[model samples]
Target: MIIRPALATELPALRTLETAAGAPFHDVGMASVAEDEPPALPVLAASLRAGRLLVAYEEGGPDGGLAGYLMWEPVDGATHIEQVSVAPAYAHRRIGQALIDRAGADGGDRPLTLTTFREVPWNAPYYARLGFRPLTDAELTPGLRAIRAHEAELGLDRWPRLCMRREAAG
Candidate 1:
């Protein structure tokens, strides 16, 4: 698999990949999440233009060969991962991790941060294995607090969630 900045023409394919990735939420009893719409095309396009959308591609496959994708942005001096999704067919592979690592590498010395379901197997626990540590409410930076608040407005607070941070790899 090769990872690179997403191209403008690949935006729609990434949305499809996100839908496929969200399907697993059904098995985890988060059917609402499974049925939730992928990010709007304009939102994704903006991320792509900002150089924060990275995609994993199979070398010789069709349909832009998207295997997975990650979107992030600089927030409060850290690289805040807004979303990361790997197609079900590519599950268990390290594509997600690779995309995150690439984001960190691109972010220089800033730490990497994200908000995710606290108990989901592939959410907080998976991030923990990747060296992220959960932050208490008091530990949340202003930007992170704002992000969490927005998530609450979107009903993501229906499930337990928290912010996590991983220091830049030395």
Candidate 2:
């Protein structure tokens, strides 16, 4: 799949992709997650406008539509992965990894950070395989702390979560 900036008109399609991406959670006993609302369209629009959003599409696959997406924020000089989603149909294709790699390149030599469910197979462990390491509580930067707080406020604290970091390659 090719990763590129998202077009403004494709925001709704992204919401659909988000829904499909979250469906696997139900199979893993996280039904609430499957039912959870994707980021609001306004939020997606803002991210897109800020050049923080990227979508993946197959070059000559089934269709020309998007297969996945990733969104990040420049937080404290690092690219903080706010969200990443790949359609279940396209799972295991390394689309998500490609998005992460793109974000790392865009971030230059700055670190990359993200908060995710600790037990999810494709969450913390997957990132660990890609060079990320779990951050100790003291290692949590202020921006990451704030992100955790917001996630808690949204009831995501019901599951074990951790902040992970992939150090910049010098």
Candidate 3:
């Protein structure tokens, strides 16, 4: 898989890949999550414009189709990972990990942070395996707190979730 900044023309493909990636949530008893729409085109376009949207493409696979994607932004001195999704067909292939690692490299000295479902096997647990640790309430930065608040307002708090952080690779 090749990981690189997303092209403007490929934004729609990332949406499709994200929807496919979300399908597994249904089997995990979170149909609402599975059915949630991918980020809107304008939101994705903004990320792309910021150079924070990265896509993983399967080399030589059907016009080099997208296999996964990750979007992030700077928040409170950290690189806040907003989303990372790999198509089920590409699961366990390390595409998500590679994307995250790339983001860490790009983030330089900043720590990597994200909010995820605490119970989902591929959420907090998966991130733990990747070196992320759950943050205590006292550890939450103002920006992270706001992000969590927004998530709660969106009804994502129906399932347990928490913020996690991984120290910078540097």
**Per-model RMSD to reference:** 1.1, 1.1, 1.0
The worst-scoring run of ten residues by lDDT in candidate 2 lies at 58-67
Kindly list the per-residue Cα lDDT of model 1 for residues 96-158, writing each as its tens digit. Answer: 999999999988998999999999999999999999999998899999999999999999999
Model 3 alpha-carbon drift over 4 Å, by segment: none
What C-alpha lDDT does candidate 3 achieve relative to the native structure? Answer: 0.93
The parts of candidate 2 lying over 4 Å away from their true place are none
Question: By TM-score, who's the top model here?
Answer: 3
Better of 2 and 3 by lDDT: 3
lDDT of prediction 1: 0.92
Q: What are the lDDT figures for the candidates, one per model?
A: 0.92, 0.90, 0.93
- Name the lDDT value of residue 58 in candidate 3: 87
Q: Give the per-residue Cα lDDT of candidate 1 at 52.
A: 95
Overlapping backbone residue pairs in candidate 2 total 0
Candidate 1, TM-score vs. the true structure?
A: 0.96
Residue 146, candidate 1: Cα error in Å is 0.2
Candidate 3, residue 21: the lDDT equals 88
- Candidate 1, 156: how far from true, in Å? 0.5
Using TM-score as the yardstick, the better of models 1 and 2 is 1
Query: What's model 3's lDDT at 53?
Result: 93
